[model samples]
Target: MWAMVTLDGLTVTYRDRPTLHGVSGSFAPGSLTAVVGPNGAGKSTLLKSILSLLPIAQGSLQVHTPRSRIAYLPQQSAIDRSFPITVHDCVLLGAWQAAGALGGLSNAVLDEADAALHTVGLCGFAQRPISALSAGQFQRVLFARLLLQDADLILLDEPFNAIDSKTTAELLALVADWHARQRTVIAVLHDHSQVHQHFPQTLLLARGVVAWGDTAEVLTPQHLGQARLLGESWDDHLHAA
Candidate 1:
C-alpha cells in the first residue's frame, strides 16, 4: 500500500510540556485505520498535528496529499453548538473551498447539500439551528459537511463518542462508504470492539507509539497494558518539579 501520511520522530508540546513524544509511523493510502489508546494518550493531539493545526515541537510530519485535500472532524467538545447557524448553512460551509471568496453557491451545490442532509437522515432539519439538535443529530450534520468536502484524506477524532448506537452504526456505514471509494480514513476511537470490527489497521499510542501495524497485532493485550501504564504515569506537575 502507498503511504499517504508519514511521521518521523514527531513530537508536539503544549506550554513547554510534551503531549506526543517522538511518534514515528505512516498511514497507508486508501486504508482505514483506528487510533486507540487510553485517555491523555495524545490521540487528539496526534490528529491536530497531522492537520497542521498544532505546531510541531520536534521531528517532521508530511502529508503526501495537499492541505485542501484533507478533511477533519474534531471531537464534539471542540465545536460550538451555540453558534446561530442553520444545519443547511453549516453543511454548506464545506463548499467554501470550491466556491472561493467571491463565488456564490450555485443551485447544484445547494441541491448537493440538501441531498447530503438527507443521506445523514436530517432531511427536514435544513432550517433548524444547530443548537436545537441533539449530539447525534449534530454529528450527522458534521458528516454531511464531510460528504460535501469530498476529500482524499479524512481524519475523525472520536467520531462515535457519546452518540447513540444507531447513530454510530450510521456513521460507521458512511465510513465504510469512504473506504469503498478508496479514500484514506484515520479515526481516533475508544471502542475496541468497533475498531476491531471495522478498521483493518490500528495504531496504538501512549504519548508515543506502542504498536503500528495490522489491527490484530497492534491491539494485543500486552500493548494495551503498556498504553494504560504510560497514560497513568503522565505527570502534569512535572513542570513544577
Candidate 2:
C-alpha cells in the first residue's frame, strides 16, 4: 500500500527565505509519529504544509486521505476563544461538514459529541462558554472536538503545550487509542521525554531532516545537539547577511 502522506523534497519559504529545505519523508498508514526540533526548526511549518494551510515553495506533499477525513488541531494560542460559542457547539462543529451537507445533525451524531466531551473528562462543560475555560480545560475541549471529527488522518500542533500532567496523560491516552484503531496521527511536540515515551516513530528536524526513524534512534544526544547547532547556524547566517 502507498504511504498515507508523502513529501518529496518539500520546501517552504517565509519572506523569501527557506524555512523548510528539501524535506522528504513518508508517514506510513496507521503510524504515530512525532516531529521534533528547536523552536524555529520548521516543525510547525511541516504540519501546515501537510494541511495545505501554507504554500509550498517547492516539491510536493501528498496526503492520501480525503479532505473531510483529515482533522487538525492547531496550537491553542491560535484559537480565538473569545468567540461566542458553547463547548457543545464547538464540539458539534467537528461534524459540521457532514451535518451541513446532510441538512442537519442526526441524533446519533449529537450523542457522539456528548460522548466525546465525556471521554475528555469534560462531562459537564457542554453548556459553558469556551471563553471561560482554563487552558487545560480548553485543550480537552479541542481533543473532544477531534474525537468527534473521527478523522482518518489527524495532525496536531503542540497538543500538550500548556497542559498539566493529568490532562497530558489523558490526552495521550486518546492519541494511543487513535493509533490502536489504525488512524494516522502526527504531532509536532517539544518534550523529548514525552515523545520518547509515547511516539514510536520520530522525525527530528532542523530546517531539514536531521533524523527520521525510530524514536529511540532519532532522539539521541548527538542528533539533538546537531539539530540545535543547525538552528544556531541559521540564526548566525541571517545576522551576518
Candidate 3:
C-alpha cells in the first residue's frame, strides 16, 4: 500500500525566502489528518508544496497520486469573488481535467456537476454570481467543486475559517463522507477542539514538524507548547536578523 504523499527533508521557499524547513512526513492513503500550528507555522505552505504550487528549496516532496486526481481548496481569502463567474461555471471548473477547455461537458459530467451542487445543499445556486455569495455559501460552492472532482487525494487549507456553526457542521459532514469513501483528506485547521473531535491523525508543525501521529498522542499539551515556543523563537530570530 503506497502512501498518498511523502516528504523527505522537505524545505519550501516563496519569494526567494524559505517558509518550511526540513519537514518530513507521509500521509497514509485514505486517512483523515488535520495539520495544526500557530500563525506563520507553514501549515498552508505544506499543502502548497504538495500541490506543486511552490518551489521545493531542499529535499523531496512526492505525491504518489497522479496530478489530475488531486484536488485542492485553498483558503477562501485567496479566492477573488469579484471575478465574473457564476456558481455553476465555478463548480464545473473542477471537471476541467475531464472536460477540456472549450470541449463541451458530456451529459454524465453535467449530471455530476448538478449532483455535486445538490450534495452541498446549494440546489438553486447554480445561476447565482459568486460575487453575491456569503463566505459560508462560497465555501459550500468550493466543496461542491471538490465533490465533482472525485479526487483521490484532497488538500484543504483552512477549510472552515470564519464560517457559521451550521455551515461548518455541514461542510464537516462532507469531509467525513470523503473519509468514509476512502479518500485521503489533509486539512489545515486551527480549531483544536474541531481537530480533536473529527480528525484521527494530527501533524503539529512550526517551520518544522513538532510531532506527527495519532491525534491524541501528537496534540498533547507538551507538544503543543513546543510548537508554540518554536514559532515564537522563529519570529524572534527573524526580527533579530
Q: Write the per-residue lDDT of candidate 1 for residues 77-106, one digit (tens) a residue.
A: 999899999999999999999999899999
Separately for all candidates shown, the number of backbone clashes (residues 3 or more apart, or on different chains) is 0, 0, 0
User: CA lDDT of each candidate?
Assistant: 0.93, 0.94, 0.93
Q: Worst ten-residue run, lDDT, model 1?
A: 232-241
Worst 10 residues of 3 by lDDT: 12-21
TM-score of 3: 0.97
Leading candidate by lDDT: 2
Q: Residue 32, candidate 3: how far off, in angstroms?
A: 0.5
Residues 1-241, candidate 2: write the lDDT tens digits: 7899999999999999888999998999999999999978998899888888899999999999898999999999899999999999999989986877567888999999999999999998999999999999999999999998899999999999987999999999999999999999999999989998999999999999999999999999999999999988988998999
Compute the lDDT for candidate 2. Answer: 0.94
Would you list the clashing residue pairs of candidate 3?
none
TM-score of each: 0.96, 0.97, 0.97
